[model samples]
Target: MNTSSKQDERIARMTFASVYPHYLAKIEKKGRTEAELHQVIEWLTGFDAPKLQQLIEDKVTFESFFREAIINKNVHLITGVICGYRVEEITNPLTQQVRYLDKLVDELAKGKKMEKILRSSL
Candidate 1:
C-alpha cells in the first residue's frame, strides 16, 4: 500500500481516548474550554457529553468512533487544510472525517466563533 493508505491504517487503529486529552490541552492552552471543545465535537459527530464520555471510557478506536457517529449534514461545509491535506480533497471518507474534527479543533484553538465553527449560519 502507499504512504497515504498506511497513514490511514494507523489513524483507524488509534483510540479516541488517547487523543482526547491532547485536543483538550491544545484548546485549553489557547484559552478555550472543554465545553467549547465538546460543542465542536458534537457539531461534527453528534455525540453528546454522556455519549462522548462513554466512548472515551470504552477506549474506542477512531474507526469505531466514526462508525458509530451521527455525522452532521453540513459536514460538506467543513473545508480546509488540516495535517497538510485538504479535508474536502481526501478520497478516504474515514480520513476526511478525522480531518474534519482536526480542522474544527484547530479553528477552536484559533479562536473562531462557535456559530461559524459549527456552521450554524450556513
Candidate 2:
C-alpha cells in the first residue's frame, strides 16, 4: 500500500474512543482534569458528556464520529499545527476535523486557558 492509502486506512479504522484514553492520560499527567478534556471535546464536536460516552461505547471510527458531528460554530478559530500538520491546511475534510480535535486536546494539555480553547463565551 502507498503512504496516502495507509494514512486513509489508519484514520478510517481508528476509533475516537480508542484514542480517548490516550488523550485523557496525556492531559491528566499534566495536572489537567478529565472534565476539562471533555469540555474541549464538547466545545469542538458539540457532543455532551453522555453523548460522548455513547460514541465510545459504540466504538465509532474517527471518520464516522466526525461525519456525524455537529461541529461547533467557533471551530474555525481552532487553527494550528497538530501532529506536525496544519489543521486548516489539511486537504481532506475528515482528516481536518480529526486534527481539529487533536489540536484542541494538545492546547488543553499545554495549559491553554479554556476560554481560548473554546474560542467563544464558554
Candidate 3:
C-alpha cells in the first residue's frame, strides 16, 4: 500500500479511548463543556452517554467504533476542511467519517453555535 493508505490504516487501528482524551482536552481548553462535546459526538455517531462510556472502557479501535455506530443520516451535511482535507471531498469513507467528527469538534472549539455545529436545520 502507499504511504497515505498506510497512515489511514494506522488511524483505523487506533483506539478511540486513546483519542478521546485529546478531543476532550481540545474543546475543554476552548471553554467548551464536556457535555457539548458529548452532544456533538452523539449527533454524529448515535452513541449515547452510557454506551460511549462503555465503548471507552472497552478500548475499541476507530474501525470498531464506527463499524458499530449508527451513523447519523445527515452526516452528508458535515462539510468543510479538517486536517488540511476538505471533509466533503474525501473519498475514503472511514477517513471522511473521522474528519466529520474532527470538523464538529473544531467548530465547537471555534465558538460556533451548537445548533449550527450540529447542522440541526439540515
The model with the greatest TM-score is 1
Evaluation by lDDT, superior candidate among 2 and 3: 3
Candidate 2: regions farther than 4 A off: 1-3
lDDT of 3 by residue, 1-122 (tens): 12278778888999999999999999999999989999999999999999999999999999999999989988999888788888888777787788889999999999999999988865
Candidate 2 or 1, higher lDDT: 1
Runs off by more than 4 Å, candidate 1: 1-3
Cα lDDT tens digits, model 1, 39-114, are 9999899999999999999999999999999999999999988888888889888888888999999999999999
**Which 10-residue span in candidate 3 carries the lowest summed lDDT?**
1-10
lDDT winner among the candidates?
Answer: 1
Q: Estimate the lDDT of model 2.
A: 0.85
lDDT of each: 0.93, 0.85, 0.89
Candidate 2 weakest lDDT stretch, 10 residues: 1-10
